[model samples]
Target: MNDKINLNYLESYAHSFTEKVCSEYFGTKKYMSGQEIIQLSPSTQVNLMVIKTLFEKWNEELEMLKANPYFDYKDMAVTEALKEFMNVLSRAIKIEKQHFIPLLEVALIDTVLLAIDPLVYFWGEIEKNPSPFHHLKASKKYIKWHEKLFSELISKGDHADEEAYKKTLSEIYHQHENQLSSPHILLQDLNKVLPLDWDQLIPKEEILTETAPIMQEPAQENPVFFEEEETPELPQETAAPAEPVDYRTSDQGEIDAPKPSLGNGKSIDPALAWARFEAEQGGLLKGPIESLEEGIAINQRFMFTKKLFDGNPDLMNHAFKSIDECDSFVEAVELINERYTSRLEWELDSEEVNEFLHLVYRKFDEK
Candidate 1:
């Protein structure tokens, strides 16, 4: 099978490959007035471009992250992105509302599934349990499922051939529909399954005397684990079934690059570089943390925004809810990434980051 599939490629197709489509998709300019700073601003255009650019990058990263077995992305990219985008855009209404309203409605469905699709969350006060892998299905039973439409459109965009898209989508639909009951494919590990008493439990020194080379653990870990380590089973809310493959960073790096992308090999800002790094490394979702040491370092760096996270039980709840909806840390990072990118692009365009922060602090401290 091909290594990496760019949903961004599909994403670009879903929305026309233009800032106008993205702007119209999100209605970013809906609130602009004739005299507003956004009046004829290329910065606004660039901001929208970067936002979509990063979203696609993050989407790819989440896929890579899911290989951790300990990380999940079903909820993050599919469920959470669906939900948060809707929540963020819920207030929108415009002259073209009729046209784009369906996207918003799709967002609502995405949110509902993401929120309730939890490996197990109460729906209408009724607790239910669904396997992430099991629920990875939906298209077969529902003739009009969203995947059919998305797949149809995506294939149509690919222009493979007449009915070629349908034929391909049919296989995908069957795979997802049947993945729940599929036989487990296990390749036994020699070292892990090696009998301890092969030589009647010979001592290491004696074994070394035979000039035996040391065996090591495989780099690939099992894919598809819930973020909650103690969970008795996979979350009831699995999106799509993506197998995780463990490899060294060096090996995985080879899997990360796009077949063809827009980069021109020019020097970019360090911040953009960092944004790209996070967007890619997280792979369509969050990455598997290498060690407690690395995780702690990340947490400490994000500690600067810790205060903004305080005094809000809702926010803590929101984090968990977001994970359940988004399915992984990488998805959360994407939302944060999008917002940060938007904030930067917006601030840069308006030249108002300083002014905006000044106002925000003034009210925050009531000074």
Candidate 2:
């Protein structure tokens, strides 16, 4: 059955379908209405409906936040930012033939793949020795049962009855164990059940690839999958005068402010700071947190600026500098609320916002 299915052909068909949908709906229309979306094929409609529902939920969450009286002015700034974000999403988005074609292909591919081979679609390509019982796990009946079981477990939350959950699982497995068909037979039933339009798109010809038999290796004790050496700690050294680094300067040739101390009225060595900065490149910020007053790390600056401030470096710099001048976290947050949020319209619910604010808290926190 795998030999008869053409993965490439399926992918191409998905792309073609996505292009057709985009051209018909997104070409002339700025935003697709739910009424119009309902007219699309059932498979396409399912994905688009999900997107539409989520967009509605986003608006609801913003409204809920705005109505909460306990939220401070700084937190309320998120509502304004979210409103602007929604405007951009709804109005600015246009179908770019080059970019948008590939975007919708995955959803279409999943729909087609599910109709053809639910086993491979859900479990990925099975490797090594195969079991008939394993294949039965992918059957629609079993999948539905698994979903229901988990849904009940999740609904019960922290107070869930573990024994009841276990019993339910046992009952479900035993109930379906004797009644389930073989994996190959289930696959045939799935193909038969596919919508006529999709069934027509798939080619009848078989294009099989040759595969070599797997040779099992003897098991060994405590096999390590991955290994990494720990980074050596830098030795403590006397603080040197802060010197200008080439990358630390803005395009206008103004050098960044001096690095903050580690709250003990002592500055880190300039060489050590530079070395730590270099090590932190291409990864997340790590400790020992030398100083919150230090300029934002290069990677973090780029990410926060891009995600929150619309990739404007000058705006990010201005916000950071303004925050640095404030004497306390409260003042810093007030500055952000008045000057930045309304003007720049930052997305408040974003993880980047929390991360940026945490750094601000560290700056004014009693060390």
Give each prediction's root-mean-square deviation over alpha carbons: 24.1, 22.8
In model 1, where do residues sit more than 4 Å from their true spots?
1-3, 17-141, 144-319, 322-367
**Top lDDT hit:** 2
| Candidate 2 ranges beyond 4 A from true positions | 1-5, 30-39, 48-100, 116-367
lDDT of each: 0.27, 0.40
Give model 2's TM-score versus the native structure.
Answer: 0.28
User: What shift in Å separates residue 21 of candidate 1 from its native position after superposition?
Assistant: 12
| TM-score of every candidate relative to the true structure | 0.19, 0.28
Native-to-model Cα distance after best TM-score fit, residue 250 in candidate 2, in Å:
54
Q: Write the per-residue lDDT of candidate 2 for residues 77-118, one digit (tens) a residue.
A: 775675467655543333344554554565455444433333
Candidate 1 per-residue C-alpha lDDT over 26-62 given as tens digits, one digit per residue, 9 for 90 to 100: 4654432112311222222222222222233443464
Give the CA lDDT, 0 to 100, for residue 314 in model 1: 42
**Which 10-residue window of candidate 2 scores lowest in summed lDDT?**
243-252
